[model samples]
Target: MSGDVVVPAHNGVRRGRPPQTPEQADEVRARIELATAAVFTEHGSRGLSVARIIERAGISRPTFYRYFGNAEQPLHSLLTLSNEGLVGGIRDALARSFEPVQLGIAIIDAYLEWARGHGPMLRPVFAELHDPASPVSGYREEAFDDIRALVRAKFTELGRPLPSPLDLDTALQTCEYVVYRVSAAAHPGSEPDPADVTEARLTMIRSVLVTLGNRADVERALTVPGIFDERV
Candidate 1:
């Protein structure tokens, strides 16, 4: 009785009470994808079940099946979202930056902002990145390739020298590590400490500057008036 999903259908069948339009279907699918991400992040893949997903999404089994074959179906979408969203954010940030220091900050801000929005979705992605059998096991490398291309182009545009390939690879990894570390420390659904955020951003900025040039570049970027804490 109470567990049954009652829908007043107009034209669609009981098992296919479809949305009025494709956009509505997309909205519903997004909700399920996010709920699946939350489930996976908190409970891992083994705990992923259609029941839990339906409960989290406040939808009937049929409704979920309408958009996804099963609970795990949304995981593929989430993987796409996790990787593409981060790369997309970074690419968009490139347009707003005009110089070396600004580029560093813009990219860092993009990453942290993405991390904040996808806080609950990062854990499952970490698992996927290391799993050899995952269909999208190459997702991380692909996303990195996209990011490196964007960074290389941005650097050339600003007349900045690109680091050796080895250096650039590690440098990009370092920035990602910084974001993951700081984001994990900050609780989702609450404001993080301003001081901690500044510290992490400055760390990313300094790491990039050091990689692009040397101590002189690092000092110059950090010394930009009012751009950083005076004590930093």
Candidate 2:
């Protein structure tokens, strides 16, 4: 009868009324995240409130507070989820390509596709991380580390050297900046039309290729019709 007192473990298992299976707990967590994203997309972080999130998520106040201490916690969760999705997509894309140039193009396309799909949810999270005064800024380093690891893994797999004139870390950091710019532009409020988004994605891909000393690959990638188009 005291569902309100249910406590969740690190793995998301909750000890409470009727006892939820791990899968159920995961579903609950995912539901909360999806609802958080939808609400955040509709109302910027500045306007976000616990009440609204709980309402949108269709969960009790106790449930919301049990999973997240505050609005920022869910935002952090969203950021983590976004990174997981991006990394997973990149891994899958890499698995499908044997050619180094094709792998590079796939990575770029994977990133842009993920951003385009999740930009609404990601914009405010990124905005907070970019703000020096925001407590969420601490997450910036974590994000950078995740991205760097992904880049390192890709280079290792391809057995290709990183571009000269810049160390791997520096090159990845620069690439992160390019991703940030593209993600910002793709944010729901500022998203360009489809044609413009395609152009921007291609531009980012070309820039990435050049930075990685793969300019020749860019021309090859462009020769494919709708090469930049989001894959189903």
The prediction achieving the highest lDDT against the true structure is 1
Best by TM-score: 1
lDDT of candidate 1 at residue 209, scale 0 to 100: 67
Task: Give candidate 1 regions above 4 Å deviation.
Answer: 1-19, 123-128, 133-137, 187-191, 214-216, 226-232
Over all chains combined, what TM-score does candidate 2 have?
0.66
Candidate 1: tens digits of C-alpha lDDT, residues 113-193: 877776655545555566776634677788889998999898798777776789888877887778667656667544557
Model 2 accuracy (lDDT, Cα): 0.68
In model 1, pairs of residues that clash are: none
Give per-model TM-scores: 0.77, 0.66
User: In model 2, which runs have C-alpha deviations exceeding 4 angstroms?
Assistant: 1-28, 42-48, 133-140, 164-192, 214-232
